[model samples]
Target: MALAGKAAVVIWNDVTPEARSDFLAWHGREHVPERVSIAGFRRGRRGRAVSGGPEFFTLYEVENEAFLGGAYLRRLNDPTPWTRRVMPAFRQASRALCRVEFSLGAGVGGFVATAVLPELADADGAFRSALQRTAEALFAAQSALTGLHLLRCDANASREKTAEHGLRRETPELPAGVLLAEAGDAAPLADVVAGFSEKMASETGRRFEAGRIAIYRLELCLAAGEVLPPWDGSPTFAGEGD
Candidate 1:
């Protein structure tokens, strides 16, 4: 399916093991719903790593790049009490504010593969054309690949500090670019994603580090219209199921 919007914020972070449950509660009960409630936001998806990379990955689709600096940034600067409670436990957090460069899909798959692709020093129209062609070929070869998205990171936009960032323990990271592929099962993407990674690297004449690529099972999903449980401003850790 086409994305809900033109741009998205992709994040990768590891929460302290001791705070995992609280993190889950904060994310599902308070975070996702709150973010989607913003005017330009569309949908949110949270995933838990089943194979590699960080413990959690979250994607928030927004109407366009402008919203990142507008309502979104405003919300970031004024965090809720629950947000403040959970933010301090975040670690190794990397975030990217991105424009959807290329995407192909019919539906949201049960599983997704995440990887950070290096930036192209002098990318041009021809480079984008090549990227689409490569994506099409890769899509055609793997039936399990139900959805795929390529995001071009806006480093400047992503690097801005906010109240939330100030609460984190470690420094924030900016990814060069990001690739997301969704499939019904994890097996098909294991080799195909690495292959695409290599081909993409070949296009840029750069080394593709596939080590960060990971397969995650979809854990939480929220949409703009979904009804969220009321947040009473308490710091209770409620799991998604709760």
Candidate 2:
């Protein structure tokens, strides 16, 4: 499957080892399902690094970029108790609310690779279009890949301040243009990702850093259809800023 819609929220972060257990519980049990239940969000996936980059990566598919500022913003501004507690555990966070530029796949896979491409030169749509075409051709030749996608950030939506932002230890960095490749397993990704970088660089007349590619293994997945109702059982639940 390509993507659920035209836009997605791509997140990268590290959770301190001291808070790892709590972070996992809060994220899988409370956070992702809550977001997917919102009107425009379609699916949420959580991945833990198998190789490089941040310790955790999150992806949320949305109907369009407009949804980022709509209900999703409200959710971020009003943090749930678990969200409040877990926010402080995050380090090196970068969330990019993006427009899905190109997507191809059979469906999502168990393993994924990501590259944080430098921001593209927006003045030349044709140049970016050529890159997209090259990506599509690369996708066609890969036997192990289950998904490939290009996402360009919507800066304004991503940088919007929220109550949740205040709970974090540091400010979140905005997403740059990103390229993600998904596969069913880890064995085939290194060579494929390297090929993508080399080929993309050749097509774009620039050096695409293959070394930046990071690998992750899917940890948790939730879709709107599977959303559980929010729980209200914790009496000691501390809301944001507590």
Reference-based TM-score of each model: 0.90, 0.87
Residue-level lDDT of model 1, residues 173-230, one tens digit each, is: 5667778899889888778778888787787665545547878899988989896767
Clashing pairs in 2: 1-106, 1-107
lDDT string, candidate 2, 1-242, tens digits: 88888999888889899999889878887989888988889999999999987888999999887788878888888999889988988998877789988788899899988778765445267667776777777778887889888788877867777998787754444546878889998887877767777776777786665335688999898988896645454434458456
What clash count goes with each model? 2, 2
Q: Would you give me the overall lDDT of model 2?
A: 0.81
Q: What number of backbone clashes does candidate 2 have, counting pairs of residues 3 or more apart or in separate chains?
A: 2
Q: Which runs of model 1 end up more than 4 angstroms from their true locations?
A: 170-172, 202-211, 231-242
Angstrom error at residue 220, model 2:
0.9
User: The CA-based lDDT of model 1 is what?
Assistant: 0.83
